[model samples]
Target: MLSIKVLGSGCANCKRLETRVRKVCADNDLDATIEKVTDYQDIMRWPILSTPGLVINETLVSQGRIPAEAEIARLLKS
Candidate 1:
């Protein structure tokens, strides 16, 4: 199963990102655990300074803004 973490400070973009992550996992038929990191200190633990960071299985895959669906799918496949 894939482990996904959406790191942000509970902004509108953060919520949207989380939603997209869930949809992607479902649409792709992937077994994933998606979690939202809303705490500032928790978000800071990663090497991302931007909101809406994407961490897949503890690896920082993307950050700053929302990513393309194809990009996400490709990431999951790898």
Candidate 2:
């Protein structure tokens, strides 16, 4: 199973990103554990300059924007 993290401060964009991530996982039937990293210190562990970061299996794959569902699905597959 994959380990995913959605890092942000509970903002709208962050929620959207989390929703999309969950949707992608459900649509693709991907086995994964999704978590939300809201604390600044915890979020900073990843090299993200902005909110709404997406981490897959401990790798930061995106930041500052909500990626498309297709792109998210692709990220999970890789």
lDDT of 1 by residue, 1-78 (tens): 889999998889989889888888889999999999998988999999888999999999999989988888889879
Candidate 1 global lDDT = 0.90
Clashes of 1: 0
Worst 10 residues of 1 by lDDT: 68-77
Candidate 2: where are CA atoms >4 Å away?
none
Candidate with the greatest TM-score versus the true structure: 2
* Residues 1-78, model 2: lDDT tens digits: 999999999999999999999999999999999999999999999999998999999999999999999999999998
Highest-lDDT candidate: 2
Per-candidate TM-score against the hidden true structure: 0.95, 0.98
When summed lDDT is taken over every stretch of 10 residues in candidate 2, the lowest stretch is: 23-32
